[model samples]
Target chain A: MTLPAEYLATPRLPLDEDGGPVFSAPWEARIFAMTVKAHEAGVFTWGEWAEALGAELAKDGDGSGETESYYDRWLAAFETLLTAKNVAAAGQLADLRKAWDKAAKATPHGKPIVLENA
Target chain B: MSAHDHDHPHDHDHSELSEIELRVRALETLLTEKGYIDPPALDELIETYETKIGPRNGALVVAKAWTDPDYRERLMKDATAAIAELGFTGRQGEHMVAVENTDDIHNMVVCTLCSCYPWTVLGLPPVWYKSAPYRSRAVRDPRGVLAEFKVELPDDTEIRVWDSTAEIRYLVIPKRPAGTDGWSEERLADLVTRNSMIGTGLALDPSSLEDAA
Candidate 1:
């Protein structure tokens, strides 16, 4: 029942008054968690994350636009960092993305999506 | 409950995936397959931020600082180590600077560049904290923002706002209330509100605590 203290870490984001879900969508939560996990695993440092995210937000010009969700920047920042850090290449990520698009289409409604479906 | 219960993994309409959704899933799959990510670590990380960390950690630190002089000295000298002494250290808290609220100096923290907060101590920054207006005005008119939070500091007090960035974060040690002279650290912690640590508001008045209880 006692997780290591490191497991119990990071600043909060996305929580509203109701103490609702920390993220608006499942993918948002996924990317958020993945970023933290990657940091812990030594894939990248939080400094690197901050830099990447800041760069992504900077691309938005004022960063208060209605078009892109906040987490979109998070994901964009993450993907860019992943490639920049050589954790994964741009071509590799792109390939996987296209494959998932196909896999999701192949999956039936309410079914768990599997990469094999690609 | 909404039909969007993502925890029910099998119940999601996989066929209705948004472009971003599919992209994220693909990234997860790729990272997992590459051994750079442990699949369960994602959930564990989420559970950590969602439940493990919070402002309570900062309250404990503030309370100890109030009750112990040597610890307070250490805290003022180096906040990151002082906070880690209470066993609250991780990514966002790598560098910390504790600024105390004195009779003439009122300290506040803001991440004007982004939401770079000391999550390891005070948990996440609030939604409004990330807004453009608060971010800008926190530097321009801290006293006004404090007034909005009902923390009317003395007119002569100089408000010092610390802009947190990726390199550093800050914690404000609110002044000990007049009547809390012999209070236990635990009791003192009850007065240390999250806003107090952020410098947006003062610690809860001792009388207010009594009234609430």
Candidate 2:
């Protein structure tokens, strides 16, 4: 039940009491489900997805990055795989991103931001 | 901001999520708009991953095998089919091989290449399971690794480390603990830890559960 002072002082991810991964934000779980759902729909194979993820993680070299960045890589690689597989074009996703920014701003403070609001 | 902190909770609602969150949301919305993903299916996927589809599924499979001799025989003969019969079949679980722990042989699983786990049953592999150290040590110094997990075994016991691959994954059936011979599979499942199914840990001692309760 003891620990090195430096290791204990270091910032760490928030884990559930039972040590399950606690998604810091809801969107982390959303993206996770999106990846699984995409695979189920045959947008890409698990092999391709793994390769894409490996490629993205390899960008981190020693893989000492934080857990948050891991999911960033996950999302980046997912987008790459979708584009490479001709499932979703880069431009379309970018446009949607802009649309969401506007939609989020135009909507009331606490309301859900829908595409039509853009 | 501090003055109204407790009163104005919506003050920073827009800033709650990071840029990446917004990006992922955008991606999901775009995919739905373009017909690549159905909202209902996406919802179900989120729900399944969040609520169902985890170690509980594997725990159930192990409990069934422990309580029923025929089910145990089926699981040993054809893990994938028997597992699927219990409604956990998809993704990385199309092919499964179940190994049993006994008084002599102990089983452990590791993916030396990448983290290829029985996701349909165990959900996702733990962060350590995907770490380089685990991937290496699980194969090289299994006893030492198990010792680190606080799982000490007799020196004479043999440890068989199964390498999980995308083609085939493993589910370890830890030996049923003595006592409570008349336990239902559901209650027995409460003793099955995720690591037990993965073979890195053992079934919870019934007494331990009692102490926790």
Candidate 3:
């Protein structure tokens, strides 16, 4: 299967063997697929995604000295793209995130997180 | 694994929500609620990586090398090509190196900077692999790190730790366990654990396999 070249060809993208992107947590995969799907659905061009993600990676030092937090920057770039494209308002996203934190706090460990106010 | 003094007490606490975990969950919820994501598709993608694509591929490679001396020599000589011959190649494993563990030597894999792992074979790294304690201690005190994992080696066994990078990744070819003569590759593969390949544990003994079953 052909994945997005914009991400695959990017030197910064860290993929697993088989060329698919690797994620440390389920949420990483979730954000990643969302970004790919968003690009596929014409919400933004691959160039835009690449530029935003590239900037994020460079800003964070790109695993030279520390390798953690690549996907964290990815999420930040994804949000930036969403807000820039007007696909989702920054305030709305922030509000939902806060709501999730509250839900997660109330829920016990090993249980799936469900947003109460969403 | 037993609690030890070397354990980094400030490392990730399993009891509470990690900052990344909480943030990712929030993002997922927001995206799904906004119609930017399909819940089922996301689930399928995650499940594929978590289960279908993981260390089983590495286990198969280890099993083959254990059974064939020539293959073992080839694997040790040129790991990237040898692993590719077995159809395990890509991403974090572009440049691969195999370090063999013998009676006199032991090898361990760690990424001091970040969690640069051989995902093509081993899959996503376990939480402990990415913890700060492991990243730092694996380089400083490998034996202490192994002890926390309950892996005790003989005093004379020299330990060689490989620090992974984005350019190259190392996989430990753990020595084959005894009493498995004439065992099928599939059965032998089942005895290989993720920890064994990482040098934090050893291949399972045949009797333990029966007990596990």
DockQ of each: 0.21, 0.13, 0.15
lDDT of 1 by residue, B1-213 (tens): 111121222443335456786678778887787787887666655554443333468999999999999999888887888898988876333577788988998998887432256766776555567666888888898888888988887889999887664556788999998899999999999999888999988888899988988
TM per candidate: 0.54, 0.54, 0.56
Q: On residues B32-94, what C-alpha lDDT tens digit does candidate 2 reach at each position?
A: 766778877876555433432233588899999999999999888888899999987763234
Which residue segments of model 2 deviate by more than 4 Å?
A: A1-118, B1-55, B113-115
Judged by whole-model lDDT over C-alpha atoms, candidate 3 comes out at 0.72
Judge candidate 1 at residue B62 and give its lDDT.
95
Q: Model 3 over residues B176-197: C-alpha lDDT tens digits?
A: 9999999999999998888999
Could you tell me the C-alpha RMSD of candidate 1 in Å? 18.4
List, residue by residue over A1-118, the lDDT tens digit for candidate 3: 3355566755476565677665544456657777776776688888888888887777865356222377778888887878888877758776766776677567543243556776
TM-score of chain A of each: 0.75, 0.77, 0.78
lDDT over C-alpha atoms for residue B66 of model 2: 93
Top candidate by DockQ: 1
RMSD in Å for model 2: 21.0
